[model samples]
Target chain A: MNLLEDTWKLEFHSGIPVYKQIIHHVQAAVAAGRLVDGDQLPTIRALHQQLNVNPNTVAKAYRELQHLGVLSAEHGSGCYIAPGAAEKSDGLSAREKKAKLTDLCARFAAEARSHGISFDDLVAQLKRQHPA
Target chain B: MNLLEDTWKLEFHSGIPVYKQIIHHVQAAVAAGRLVDGDQLPTIRALHQQLNVNPNTVAKAYRELQHLGVLSAEHGSGCYIAPGAAEKSDGLSAREKKAKLTDLCARFAAEARSHGISFDDLVAQLKRQHPA
Candidate 1:
């Protein structure tokens, strides 16, 4: 898959709002450097069709991203990744960072349990995610 | 901490709605058997104070859980974990399960990155979560 692909994997069962999830996906992509400054995103209509969600939902996500300074919009044009967004990394304190890791691990373990992924198999997958 | 403790470690920066996060925490607790049927939940005001979130947020989460049949309410008494909530597990298909795991891993990786957690450290933590 292309790093800049506009794929928005929507999980209806996650209990998170779809628009919020879209914002998360875009932010994560930006953090990973898969998206960078001035990179145009899919149009609201296009993204709506791609995700099978309401166009308004896509628009809301875009608007929220713009408000967060993560996206820039031009009149009658589309949104692009914002400048200096990549520089927003590494702002968290040590305690905040530890909390994030703990929260993430707990969430991952819970999902693995629900998916019937055994502890051993989960460890194997985790190793693959970070090969030596 | 006791499994039934009403402590909610909320991550305000996660972009997930606070109320939804509370709902997710409760559902995850139930799924892990840390919370079970007949388990009384903290009252709205109590949880609001505990998490330092709005009381309405806690009430909204409880209402949503009740609607989803995960919680039962009593007029004067408080909410309790609903019966048969545990048996509601494992209804997902293999494909759906795989998608969930993929989503989870990507999320974990993104968080691990933002937290400046080295891949080695992350793998070590994952290993600790699943001992022989």
Candidate 2:
């Protein structure tokens, strides 16, 4: 799990796409200034070994990040972080999404109450995940 | 745009999947107690008219919620909120995601700094979008 440690963690069943998940974690790191540019990402082979996933899957995730301009490979030095990668604005689209999403959730909860679904029951359902 | 209004708002970009985005908004509503279970969704026709999207897309999103047992449509009375539908534990997977995403973004930002990219440049890129 060195690769997992070196990079951000991952969850397979979060319902978010693998590549997007990677992007999210990377973006978060960039925004917070934990990862510096020119840092070498784990090699695809190394990541595959740690995650026990297919090489292609690792490659695909890396490729997606590269497409996002987050990662770049220079000759044999491995993949390095791009400069000035972090910093999405609080007023940008992402922040808007947070606002919209918050509003929607508030409404859904209200509607659920109008229907008589007990709060306890709702909590149970959300916490109860079928084991894989 | 009644359906859109009555429910949550949406955006096509942001890279999050449409269905998941809907789920996110609804989940938030439920968690925050805005949407109760048994709430009827807008008629497929209504949603289609507002978003100008295919009927199947709207149906698909609804069906997903139904499968999660969030909605129960009556034959003629329309969709109503389900009882006690709004509630998910803050400790569950979602909260974890927030943490991981935050961590990742921080790292990415640091990496960018190491590469000598200014924070201003990063902010500009996020705000600038290629027009469709």
Q: Tens digits of per-residue lDDT for model 1 on B1-132?
A: 233365567878855578877876776676667778898888887888777889999999999889878899897899999998766556554455446666677677777876766455455456555534
- Pick by TM-score: which candidate is best? 1
Best by lDDT: 1
Residue B14 accuracy (lDDT) in model 1: 55
- Of all true interface contacts, what fraction is found in model 1? 0.33
TM-score of each: 0.40, 0.37
Interface RMSD of 1: 8.8
Q: Report the backbone clash tally of model 2.
A: 64
RMSD of each: 14.3, 14.4
Candidate that would win on DockQ: 1
**lDDT per model, in order?**
0.71, 0.53
What would the TM-score be for candidate 2 when compared with the true structure? Answer: 0.37
Please give, for residues A15-121, the per-residue lDDT of candidate 2 as tens digits.
44565555555555555555667777778788778767787877787787776677786766677788755433222243343344344334434543444333333
Under CAPRI classification, how is model 1 graded?
incorrect
lDDT over C-alpha atoms for residue A115 of model 1: 68
